[model samples]
Target: MKKLLIMAALIFAAHFAYAQSENIEEIQQFIISDVRYNKADVTPIYLDAKAYISLYRVKDEETIYMANVWPAKRSQSYGYIYDLKQTSVDATDDTYKNETLTFKWSYKNDFDNKQGTATIKLGLVYKPTGIAFLMTMITEDLNVTEFKGYVSGSLNLK
Candidate 1:
C-alpha cells in the first residue's frame, strides 16, 4: 500500500510538471535606478535582472518606459523573447513629483540570488520622436518583474 501511494504521489507531481505553463509567465520583478536626467544625455539606468533598462529618455529628465520581457513562447531558443508592454514613469525632480508606473503583473521569478539585467535599453528622446539609447548593465540580485505601463494604461499578456 505504501509503495502504491508513493507512486501515485510521484505521478501527480509529474502531471503538474507537465501541466506547466506553455507561455513564459509575465512576472513583476523588474526594478529601475532612480536617476536625474536632463534634456541632454541618456541616463545610466539599472536593469532589474536581465541586463535590461527599465526606462530611459534623453530630454524628458523624467519618466521612463520599461520593457517587460519574457520568452516569445515555449521554445528552446535562447533568444526568443518579447516586450509585452512598457511602464510609463515620471522621474522625481525638484520641478515635479515622482510618479510610479502603474503595472499589472501575474508572473514570478525569484532571480535575486543571481546577477542578471537587460542590455541595450533604449527609448524615445521626448516621446513619439528619435530613439534615445542607454547601454544596459547588471550587478544586483532581483526578482523578474513583469508588466509595464503608464498612469492611464497597463501592459500585460491576454
Candidate 2:
C-alpha cells in the first residue's frame, strides 16, 4: 500500500511540473509589434520592429523579470529589463480578459549622462481572435527630459 501511494504521489508531481512548464512557455511566447515612442514636446517615433519578449518568474512567481532585446540604431541593439512590482490575471471578464503587470524601475545611463526612472504599466488582453498588448512608459531624467509613450502589440502566445 505504501509503495502504491508513493507511485501515485510521483505521478501527480510529474503532472504538476509539466503544467508549470507549459505555463512558462506560454508566457515566453509574447510577440511585440506596433512599437511607438514619444518624448515631452518632441515628435513621436514609430518603430517597425518585431521581437519576442519573455517574462521569467522566480521564487515561486513572487519576482518577475521581463527582458527583451531589439535593434536600436544602424548596428546597435537596445535592451530593456523590468522587474515587475505587481501582477494580476483576469480571465473571467468577457470584454477585457488580460494579464496586467506593473513595474517601477530606475537606472543610470552613463554614456548618455542620464539618471532615469520609469514606471511601466503593461497588459496582455485576450481577444476572441488574437492576443493584444498595451504598454505605457513614463520616464524621468532621460537626457534631462521627461518622456511618455503608449505602444500596442499583438501577442502570439499559445
Candidate 3:
C-alpha cells in the first residue's frame, strides 16, 4: 500500500509540472493593435499601430516578446523591439466566466539600462465564435496603457 501511495504521489507531481509548463506554451502570438497611453496632467493618446506580442518559454524561463512598438519609429514603418522577463503569473482555471491571466515582468532598457517593472493583465472574453483579449499594462513609471485586439489562440488558465 505504501508503494502504491508513493506512485500516486509521483504521478500527481508530474502531472502538475506538465500542466504548469503547458500553461505558458499554449499562448499564441497576437497583435496588440490599439495602444492607449495615459500620463499625468495630459489627455490619453491612442496609437493605432500594428504591434505584435508573444509569450514563450526560453531555457525553462518564460519570456514576453513585444515587437514593432512605439519609441522606435524611425520613419513611418517601424519601432523598437523589446522583450521582458516574466517574473510572476497568476491564472484562473474556471472557464464559465471571463478567464483572466495576470503576468508581471521585470525589464531593463537596453539603450539606457534603466530598469522597470510592468504588469500585464489579459482577459479572455468568453464568446460563442471568436476569442478576444483585452490587455492592460501598468509600468513602473506609472504609465498606464491599454491594448485591445483579437487573438487566434487561447491561454491555458490553470
Better of 2 and 3 by TM-score: 3
- Per-residue lDDT tens digits of candidate 1, residues 55-155? 32224234333333322321111221224344344534432322222222222233332223333222322222212332222213432222222211222
- Tens-digit lDDT track for model 2 on 14-99? 99968865655223444554444553333223233333345555444644445433334222111244666556566774565667
> lDDT for every model?
0.31, 0.51, 0.54
Q: Write the residue-wise lDDT of candidate 3 on 1-158 in tens digits.
A: 99999999999999996876565543465555565677332212323333455554434544444322333332121112244322323334754345677756555554455666677677766554556677777887878877776675553444
Cα lDDT for residue 43, model 3?
A: 19
Candidate with better lDDT, 1 vs 3: 3
Candidate 3 clashes: the total is 0
Evaluated at residue 21, the lDDT of candidate 1 is 32
**What TM-score would every model get versus the actual structure?**
0.22, 0.45, 0.50
Best TM-score among the predictions, by candidate number: 3
lDDT of 2 at 117: 64
Using alpha carbons, what is the TM-score of model 3?
0.50
Model 3 CA lDDT for position 142: 74
* lDDT for residue 66 in candidate 1, whole number 0-100: 37
- Model 3 whole-model lDDT (C-alpha atoms): 0.54
